[model samples]
Target: MPSLRIMPKVMTLTDAAAARVSALIAQKPGVKALKIGVKKGGCAGMEYTMTWAEEIGKFDEIIEEKGAVVLIDPAAMMYLLGTEMDYKTDKLSSQFVFNNPNQKSACGCGESVNLEPATPPGFAPAEA
Candidate 1:
């Protein structure tokens, strides 16, 4: 029999991020997780999109840490690989932040980013 290979997780969450997400889940009843993706239109060419996921999608990659659950859109998986999710708070505001290795650049205001697709180790593209 062929050996089974387990796919690696796309991203990870920090303690503060997990706690914040857990709190958000508690406030909204019946929501499964926070869905994350990338979109076009930002000055940097790409922007992150997040929403409450009521149910899991067939291709969604799920990450659960410290009681916080997050869903990664399949289309954005490559762009988000090796990213770390964090929550930050200051006197003026609080927000979730993404530290992504594949990011090339971000807009001046930090509203968007430019990213390159990441290929997993040992992965090879199919012949055209």
Candidate 2:
């Protein structure tokens, strides 16, 4: 069997977040993994998408950390670079949070995010 390896990138998850994800998976039967990605069509131009995965597709980018599997859509990798996943709990509510460094801004409701395009390899912007 081929070893599963994650590419060295800026994306990461907090220990607390990882533990919460593990607990979620354990509580839900038949959930093989978790999928995280970005999608178009949101107030801030981009939105995060997450779903429970029963099976992993061939093109899915599997990132395993702290005993949890995070499946990333191949195409969404670029836009999700430098992202961090965190779990939050408060008096009124608790939820998974995303700290994305590429983000330029977010809407008032916090339901959407806008990100800067990924820089190409070895490419630099010209000075104005």
Candidate 3:
């Protein structure tokens, strides 16, 4: 029998991110997960969007780790592949950070980023 190939996850979370996610969802009763996506309104051409999800979407890519459940919007998958979600805290502030391999650049204010779609391993672009 031929072996089936396993696919890589679109995203993963760090321990800090998972703990923070677990804490955030604990505040709201019946919250299902955290949803993440990208939007096209920032100066750098894209912005990450996050929302508390009460329900999962049909095509969402789900990543659960250390009791934290995150739903990645299907539309954002290509841009999010090989990305790692992290939570960082300093004296000034705390925030969730995305370490994405597909990111090309970021805006001055750190509110937006320019991203390119990730090309999966062994994938070849169709000749145009």
Q: Among these predicted structures, which one has the highest lDDT?
A: 3
Instruction: Note the Cα lDDT for every prediction shown.
Output: 0.93, 0.82, 0.95
Better of 1 and 3 by TM-score: 3
**Per-prediction CA RMSD (Å):** 2.0, 4.4, 1.5
| Worst 10 contiguous positions by lDDT, candidate 2 | 119-128
Alpha-carbon runs more than 4 Å astray in model 1: 124-128
Of the pair 1 and 2, which is ahead by TM-score? 1
Each prediction's number of clashing residue pairs? 0, 0, 0
Q: Model 1 misses residue 18 by how many Å?
A: 0.5
lDDT order, best first, reads 3, 1, 2
Model 1, 1-128: lDDT tens digits are: 99999877798999999999999989999998999999886899999999999999999999999999999999999999999999999999899999999899999999999988887889884455
> Which of candidates 2 and 3 is the stronger one according to lDDT?
3
Error of 2 at 6 (Å): 9.7
For model 3, residues 7-109, the per-residue Cα lDDT tens digits are 8989999999999999999999989999999989789999999999999999999999989999999999999999999999999999999999999999999
lDDT of 2 by residue, 4-97 (tens): 9655464578998889888889998999888998888678898889999999989987878897778888778877777889999999989889
Off by over 4 Å in 2: 1-6, 120-128
By TM-score, who's the top model here? 3
